[model samples]
Target chain A: MRKYLFIYKSEIMSELQYVFNILIGFIGYVIILFIFLNLWKYIYNDPNELINGYNMNQMIWYVIITEILWSSLGGRKLCRKICDDVRGGNIAYNINKPYSYIGYSLFSHLGSATIRGILYIILGMILGFIFLGSFPNLNILSILAVLLSGILATIISTLLIIFIGLLAFIIEDSNPFYWLYSKAMLVLGTIFPIEYFPKVMQTILKYSPIYVVSYGPAKLFVEFSWPNFITIIFWQLIYILIAYGLCAILYKKGVKNLNVNGG
Target chain B: MLMVVKNQLKISWLSIKYALIREMLNKTTFLTNIIFMVLNNASFIVQWIILYSLKDNVGGYTFKQVLLLWGIASGTYGVAHFFFKKAFSLSDTINTGKLDSYLVQPKNVLISAITTDIDTSALGDMIYAYITLFIYGVTLPNFLLFTFFCIIGGIFLTSISIILSSLSFWFSKSDIIADTGNGLMTNFATYPDGIFKGIVKILLFTLIPVGIVNYIPVRVMVSFNLGSFLIVIMATIFIVILAFLVFYKGLKKYSSSNLMMAKI
Candidate 1:
């Protein structure tokens, strides 16, 4: 635990040096969010119109929050590192390290994600203010709750992406699965709320990662309620455990067939 | 003059043909790449489907009109990616001195460099575009307009990429600008034009140029207008010429070894 803490601390400092790089990457988020803001503005004909119990303010805020969480987590690079480690035989070197491979990867990436997430939040607030002219109303309790949910959401996504990367041991390419997972995240909860989905999909997605990973934190931020927070955080906890177990299982099994090419 | 034009076209055709053949060497991978990309893109449409279910109109677009927006976007993106995929990587090529090999070639350097590689997955985007067009409803005139716009949009995208990537000659790590610029163009192109107004809309046309890529062309397809079509043509020509000018001007700064490119 202490060693993981060291990694977490060090990785934050290391990732901080790449602030310029991260800012450049934020360009995509800025564009996508701007487009969504425009889309939502054009959808809600009346400024006070409500669709599925969300007002114009909440709807735009929903996009801002989801995009912040998704981009900050840096799900793409997380999987690539894992995928490359598993496929490129770097796992052979990784397993012999002092601590758990999963712990090391999780904490280090989390450190990086923490820096990126903070930046995204600041940017989101500024963008939100400019685009919508108002912020979502939340108290101190709601703010803390949403922050907790966001952390849990990041953990769940990280564990799942690690699990996907470890799949390179079993499959020719784990990229396709990663692609499917990202699209599922993007389409289901990131683009819009689960309520916007068909009733059937809404029910199914509630039990899926869409509930914990992408939708949960944003929902909390937009419409923070005690029941919603409890439900989302509980599911997030369960999904993170499940994701962790999957990675442990895959890693234990996968290390057997690992091959190293060079001397 | 005519002979030079014909020869350049022949060269581009051969370059694309060979790139395609190289990609097809792995049959299963090639097929799966196309298939998977189509599926990947189709998933985004689900968002629109869900949105339209609750509302009759969004951003002044009917459901079908929105699909046309998507179709034009898809078609243009596919054409650009499939035909000039290397333009997207022009910064990397410049950074890594990948230009050395192309510089030695007998044909045009920019053309040879950009048309050398093909993204097989882009074939899926092309297939998806046509599927959406068919779903929207087809007419001979509409079909012709769509095809023309695809070419126009592809050229526009390629030029944008080239112009952005050419910045690598003057600066380190300029791929960031190229990538972000390209992303802005592609992302904005798929969106409904009515949603944007005032300065942002103006920026899209003049600075980002996504308006020229899809919006105007989509207008021509939905309701044929000579004026809009001519703007598309004129803008595309101006952008392409600008791309050439930028690349050539930057080429004078090219040294065979850039420290950044040598980083592996």
Candidate 2:
């Protein structure tokens, strides 16, 4: 455990070495936020008006929070790492390691997520202040609930991404799938709140793990109602269990076929 | 001149035929391409629905006009993919050093790279757009002209795709750049050209050149003026020529690998 913690620290230290890149990434995030804000302006068209159950202020606030959440997800970076490891024959090294593959993957993911999450949170809070004039309500219990749910959301997201990324092991070329899925998520994840989806779609998306990553957190950040909070936590736990089971089966199968070539 | 024109048509036809066959036979590649097309169209529908729910039109565009915009965007995207799908995958080729193989080919590397990897799934979107346009655009006054300019717009889109792919040689990462180009293209092309004024119009016309794809042509078709129509055609030719120059200039920077390295 201590060794893994050390590994996580070194990994973070290495990431911090590239301070400029992180700053530039934050700038890019702000630009995207600007574009999305403009889009909402067009969507609203009238001052202080509401569209689709959300007021202009609420809509802008929603966009800001979602952008922050979206940036933190970082599924693309995780997907790229998995594909690179598989393609570059580094999966064999991972297999030889002492810890379970999934454990190692999750830890490393947590480290990367930590850095991105901080940047996103700080930037999001500042942007939220500028946009909303203050933070949303955050009682002690609700704050605790959000922290717990956020962790669960991150786990579910990471595991789901790992499952998708593992397709690289099975398919000769999975680049197109990765690109298509990520882009689809980017557009679909933002356009409509999943709750606004038709009843049937909402039900289907509730089970599909992608919704948990984006919509669940977006809702929590906005409303933070008790029933909504408990529901997401319950679903997230269920997803994590399912993800663990799939990862175990696949990792065992993948390891058996793993062949290490030139480093 | 007649002979030259005839030869060009024959060559282009033959290339299209072969490309179509290659795409149809490759099941995985074909399916992958179709999935992206479906996702893109689905997202557009969602946006359209949202807009309709809000009002009859967005920024003076009627329901039919919105459909027309979708038809135009999807049709041009499909046409571009049919001719230059390989442009979308240029990042992988460059990153993996597979571009060396294209550079070493004796033929025009830009044409060779793009045509060799045809994406026929774009055919699905093309069919969808054609049906939608036929159904919706048939009611418009300038129906025939709209169809004619759609073809020209498609050609311009193909030119843009090729040019964007060629940019991979100059930039280490073209995926983001290509994505940015597509975003800008969709946002600009879907709107009626009249909404943009002054410097923005000039920027789209000269710098971005997205105006050549759907905007300028659609605007001309609506106006029903011979001079505006002629200008649209001239703009398309200019953009295509400029794209050709960009590709050739970038080709000088493209490096290729030999047979031994291609052994995967």
Candidate 3:
């Protein structure tokens, strides 16, 4: 735990050096948010009308919250690092280190993301207020729920990326897998609520990672309810177990293959 | 002048040829990238389909017109990346002094730098663009016009990247600015222009040029407007000349890295 904390602390310190890069990266999201704000305004045609059970403000805020999760999760960086480690045979060196590679990766990512996530949330809120005139009407309890769910979703997202990266042990590259996973999250989760999807896809996606990873936190933030909160937590637990179990099995087998190959 | 243009075109062809061969060496990864990119792009179209299902039009764009908008966007992006992928990363090349290779070579530096690589997945985008066009109903004349606009749009997009990246000549770490500019152009190109108004619309046309890259192309494709089509052509020529001027002007300030690197 102490070693992981050290790793986390180091990452946070290093990331602070690139504060401008981090902020500039958010420009794309801001542009997209502005487009969505105008788009929903035009679509809704009336501020009071609810097209898909969400008023204009609620709809735009939903996008803001989900997009924040999307950008702050650090899934792409995690996947690329793991992929590089495996492909470049650096994982063998990492295995010899005092700390577990998985723990170091997870903690370092979380530490760096902690700072960026806060900044992103602040930016999202600023954009929200600029376009919609106010923030989401959330009390302390709901904010707490959203934060907890966001952390879990981040974990699940990171685990999924690691699992994809582990495929580098067998394949030449695992970026294509990350590509598909990100597109799934982007189209199904971030851009629109599940309600906006086709009825069939919505039903199926409810049980998929989109629910726990992207939709759950944003949904709870916009319209909090006890049943939805409990359901999200339950799904997150199941996803956690699945991601962890698969990663453990894959890592074991992958390392064995590497050893047999004299890597 | 004719001899110089011919030599540059030959060099560009060779560069693209080598880049494609290098990528094809890893056949499985190459195929996987292209196939998955098509699927990924398809997912966005699905989102648009769902949205159109809810309403008749968005920003006065019918579903079919939206299809054309996406077709132009994807096709233009494909042409830029598939043939000149390194244009998108020109800032990194300049900042790291990788321009040394192109400078040492006896060719147009900007063209040589941009043509030295291909993004295999962008081929998928090109194919997907045509698929979208086919679904929108393809006639011979319309197909030719779309292809023409895609070339213009591709040049326009690459010019924007070059202009932004050329700023690396002045600033130490301007890659982020280039990236932001590129991102804004890409993001704005997919949406309907009618949604934006006033200052935002003006900025889109002047600074980002998403209007010339995408919106105008879609407009010309939807209805045969001779005036708008001519504007797209003229703007493409103007941007290409401007990109060349900026890149060469910046080249005067380039300090070679002297690092031994070769374009594989």
Candidate 4:
């Protein structure tokens, strides 16, 4: 635990050095948010018209919350690191270390993300306020639920990314897999709610990782309900087990294969 | 002057040829990248389709017009990345002093630098663009006009990247600035311009130039406007010349990394 804390602290300190870069990166997010604001405004035509059960304000805020979750998770960078390590034979060096590689990855990523996530959320909320004239109405309990679900979503996202990276054991590059997964999340979950998808896709996506990783937190934030919270928590628990179980199996098999090849 | 231009063209052609061959060395990865990129880009269209199903038009853009907008955007991006991918990464090349290789070579440094690599996935964008056009009803004139506009838009996009990246001459970490600028261009290029009004619309035309890249092209293609077509051509030429001037001016401040490397 202490070792992991040290790793986390180190990552946060290093990330802090590039504060300007962090801010610059947010420019893209802001521009996309601006476009969405205008787009939803144009689409609504009437202020009171509800599209897919969401008012224009709710729709834009939904996009904001989901984008925040997506950006702050740092799954792409983590997945790239794992893919590079496995492909470059650097994973062999880490396997002999005292700490669990998966734990190290998770803690370090979360530590780096903690600062970034907070900054992004604050920026996103400011943008939301500026565009929509207010923030989402939420009680303290609902906000707490959103935060908890967000953390679980981040973990599940990171685990799934690690699973994709582990595919390097079989394939030469795992980026294509990551690309497909990310597009699914972006199209199905982040940019629009599942309700906005086709009826068939909505049903399928509800059972997929997109439901837990992105939709759950954003959905709870916009319109909190006990039934939805319970459902999301149940999905999160299942995804956690599946992600962990898959990673363990793949990591063991991958390391053994690497050893046999004298890597 | 003609002789110089001819020599530079030959050198650029050779650089591109070698880059393509190098990429082809990993044929499987190349094909996978192209295929997956097409699939990824197609997913965005699916989202738009869903949106269109709910409404007749977005910002006065019918579903078919939206298809043309994407076709132009993806096609222009394809031309830039497929031919001169290093234009986007020019800041890193300048900051890290990787420009040393081009300097040592006896060719047009800017041309050589940007033409030295091919992003295979952009080929997918090119194919996807043409497919979208075919779906939008391909006529002989429409096909020719679309291809011409794509070339103009591609040049404009690359010029924007070059102008932004040339800031590395004065700033230490201008790469981030360049990236943000490029991101803005890409984000704005995809959306219908009718939604933006007043100052934002003006800025899009002058500063970011997404208007020339997509909006002007889309409008010209739809209505055959001679005035707008000429404006796009002139803007593209002006930007290209400006990019050259900025890059050469910055070359005076470029210091070498002193690390020995070779262009493959």
TM-score versus the correct structure, for each prediction: 0.93, 0.74, 0.96, 0.96
Per residue, candidate 1 scores C-alpha lDDT tens digits across B173-241 of 889889989888888877787889899989988998888888888778878899999999999899999
What is the Å distance of residue A153 in model 2 from its true position? 2.5
Q: Candidate 3's residue-wise lDDT over A1-263, tens digit each?
A: 99999898998999899887788878878888988988888778788898778888888989998999989876888899898888888898977789877777778888888878888999998888888787777888888988999989988888888899999888868888898899889888988888887688889999999999999999998888989999999999999999878887888888888842355
True contacts kept of 1: 0.69
In candidate 2, the second chain superimposes onto the true chain B with a TM-score of: 0.75
Off by over 4 Å in 3: A259-263, B262-264
Candidate 3 clash pair list: none
Looking at model 3, residue B71 earns an lDDT score of 87
TM-score of 3: 0.96
Docking quality of model 1: it rates as: medium
lDDT tens digits, residue span B149-200, model 4: 8877888889889989999998987887788888888889878998887899
On lDDT, the stronger of 1 and 4 is 4
TM-score of chain A of 3: 0.94
Q: What C-alpha lDDT, on a 0 to 100 scale, does residue B216 get in candidate 4?
A: 89
Q: Rank the candidates by lDDT, best first.
A: 4, 3, 1, 2
What tens-digit string does per-residue lDDT give for candidate 2 at A53-119? 6666566556666676666767778877787777678788777678876777776777777787778
The DockQ leader among the candidates is 3
Models ranked on DockQ? 3, 4, 1, 2
